[model samples]
Target: MLRGPRRPLWLCLCLCLLLLLLLPGAPGHRGDAGPRNKKAGSGRPWPAFQGLQERLRAAGALSRRYWALFSCRVWPENCEEDEEALAGTLGLKSDLSVRLHGQHLAGELILRTVRGYLELPRPDKALVLSFHGWSGTGKNFVARMLAENLYRDGLRSDCVKVFIATFHFPHPKFVDLYKERLTGQIRETQERCRQTLFIFDEAEKLHPELLEALRPHLGRQAPENYKAQSLRTIFLFLSNLGSNIINEEVLNLLKAGWLREEITLEHLEPRLQAQIVESTDSAFGHSCLVKENLIDFFVPFLPLEYRHVRLCARDAFLSQELLYTEEALDEIAKMMVYVPKEEQLFSSQGCKSISQRINYFLP
Candidate 1:
């Protein structure tokens, strides 16, 4: 105590000890050590499926479509392989199903035959190409919604002449490569179908070159007196790309007439237009399309509210028919609590968050 220099050293040591004690796992520490150290299998539960029974009753929905996507199916061995062959095709490792955030994130590519030669009285001629974004699957919520809508429009599994080809772009590296592969596939498949609609889920991932290649085909009408072949080809590029790439190589392609001017601008929805204009990033901040050329259809990003969450959760739960048990739901729910609400849902962070918890739960 008498030596000034020695006193400061002793004070510094005490302060460090105080910080150590304050940290988790310190003696008498009380805060949650996070989902990792929670009591085995004791966590927030998934809202019970039975709780939604009344809601379903009021909605007058009782079909498998209401809850089948979430449920895992052990299809006959090679069912996926057969389905791929029947549809345009993609290589997948497992039966397609939506995964809980707590489970390992697995990527899958699927092709569901919307309509074809068998159902149609005459050969149909149309194909729809769909692309999904980061952390988004080819068969996730948005894709399923679009599919259901298409199915309701007299487009049966093998009629309407529209072959739906979906690809999974889980990594940036996969984007250009996927486009190259898809271009070849589309060229081959187009000959079989009369017309084609290329749908890009998150078009931003698509390379400029690919979009350029498809531009010549988008919105082109057949020659006059061509028997009205009903060849209404469409290219639907859905992206959060917006105006951000104002000066990127891809944008230059658009400026240089690589893409059809009208198709590029008219296809982008208004919300995306705003995002492009408002964002500060050079790549996405500016408009992707020139004046008068916008997206054909624009589905805005859904609002963020508890009601939206409840709706999404209900939709997700009902889509899968409550396959997860109460315990499993609890484990997943607990894991989600550690993730920020804004950052949750169809995001890679959700995957990492769950993986961390799973590691903690396992021996």
Candidate 2:
């Protein structure tokens, strides 16, 4: 009886071993047969799959941008801030000398103030510049020039934060929310570097409340804890608040045969201040910056004449490495629509579109 029972048990054990060997996880099926069989149909090699995963992990764990924000490496090649580099940057690199016309005061004042600010061991106040001008008058250009001189990247620098009202804070109803976000961003960026540049473009469209939020950053007397942080930051506001008035004043001087050079900051600034306060947009009219003398410089960019437009055309052609005759350049300039019907010769829109227009004339 024991022999018969033992035979059945041994037979069952043998059958179990056979079943285990036939299953997917059987011993020989592991490394080569089982896993390789599954991936054998895949065209990509195994190393490529590993490489893809490694790249994704590297993008996350060792991201350069994340570290860069917190690191002093935010500024690269700071040698550009030297005096010689600064001179070459503003003098020959961009056509600030040639492009900026009828606004010598604005250029000289900006160069002086910016240079002085950079030279300071620890500036007492942040350099706040409010650029008031019509479109295409080089306010944005000047802002770029400032960044280019300060750093190698120009306006594209990580230290420079350009905020456009239309892009950043569009809705008037949600002005409060925008205010908080804007303030937070400024505060965080300022913490990174003392030489931070904050450019607010289309500032005329910025809600008064939103602009008010920046008052603390632009203040001459920053709070005790924030003094050092505030002085190193520069806030630049580019607006079209008094664009119409500026163009009219220039026309009047020209008609009176007043030398364009005769136009000075004293003649234009007061009028611009008054016009900005009286603007149709209530946001501009009730601006705290206007009420309080917080902004350091109220730089004005005069409208560009036909000659400036021609210069822009020449520059555009040169940039494209195409040499054109004077007649072709004149043809491109004539295509632009100018203002003050009596003086249609002068471009009201400036040289903003000349670069694109020159394309039609080029071979």
Candidate 3:
């Protein structure tokens, strides 16, 4: 009886194959073929497993968004806005205090003006700063400092634009063309960044037409309109137009035994403004920027003294990692001719050539 029943060969083969597929770790088992084959065999993943995968994908997306929000905090270079840079008053003040040797008035006024402008909730017009000084005074230096402290990229920032009159708008005949281009540039820059800086160097040479074109942007808008169309913009006008008056005033104050710290804006601003207004040789004098009172601050940079020059030389030496004796500093300071022969009071060229002067001491 035990040998009576005999299954067909095909039926026996099918049974053996089914047993192999069900057993774990067995040849031809579903575990050996992996989850993909199992899912393929079943047509779809289990409902719970599919939901878990979706949840994992969503969690990854959320982590990326969270990283983006705080990445700037960890690495300032990644910041979208320059608010932190603009708010760095202490760094700016320290740089001005230590490096900018001669011009106390310039250092103080610029720091205060820029800080106040940045602190505003909404400003009616762009901040306009007019820097008047001698050839070697700290006009350009201070401007660079402002750029460095206010922007991560400094002068190279996309938000910062520098226009030199002779270099940019060389021909008087091309005034209209310059105006259109400048207006377009301003509009485009403002559209791209909220806080923008425009530096017009050799401002005295700026054409009257160009200055007029800038009038609307620099002028105050009505409160209602200003809020809607507000752009945080800064305009810097660096010129040597009133350098003579500035030097004379500073010299007189020094001769009168007034401390350098004692001299303030009240002593210089009125005279410098008057000098710019009366002069006709430069377009800056008669431009509506002055007549309409759009130029906010007429900052004056006083002439540098012997001590200031020596300090500059020391700084240059340190910057280049060069060893210098006190006598070497004295020699460098002496190389620069001082004006008013009798008094020999001020350095003719501020610290403009100081970096080059240090080469003489090199081996």
Indicate the TM-score of model 1: 0.39
Give me the displacement of residue 270 in model 1, in angstroms.
Answer: 5.0
lDDT of 3 at 52: 29
Q: Write the per-residue lDDT of candidate 1 for residues 116-143, one digit (tens) a residue.
A: 3113333323333332222321224334
Rank candidates by TM-score, best first: 3, 2, 1
Which candidate number would show the highest TM-score if scored against the true structure?
Answer: 3
Over the stretch 1-363, how does candidate 2's per-residue lDDT look in tens digits? 000111233444544454454446666332221112123225434432322322232232213212322222224454332332223233322234544554676877787787676667666667888898878778887887667655546677667889998998888899888988988888777776546888999988888788788777776653576654734677899998888888888788888887777788887888888888888775855777777877887887888777667666766775575655567667877888888787784576777777788778756
lDDT-better candidate, 1 vs 2? 2
Deviation from truth (RMSD, Å), model 3: 25.5
lDDT of 1: 0.34
TM-score of each: 0.39, 0.72, 0.76
Judged by lDDT against the true structure, how good is candidate 2?
A: 0.65
Question: What lDDT tens digits, residue by residue, belong to model 3 across residues 1-363?
Answer: 001123444544544454444446655233221112121225433433322222233233323323433344556685643344343454467578766887888998899999888877677889999999998788988889888766667788888899999999999999999999999998887877767889999999998899999987898888876654436889999999989998899889989999988999999988999999999899798999999889889999999888888878877876665555666778888999898898998888888889998888788
Pick the winner on TM-score between candidates 1 and 2. 2
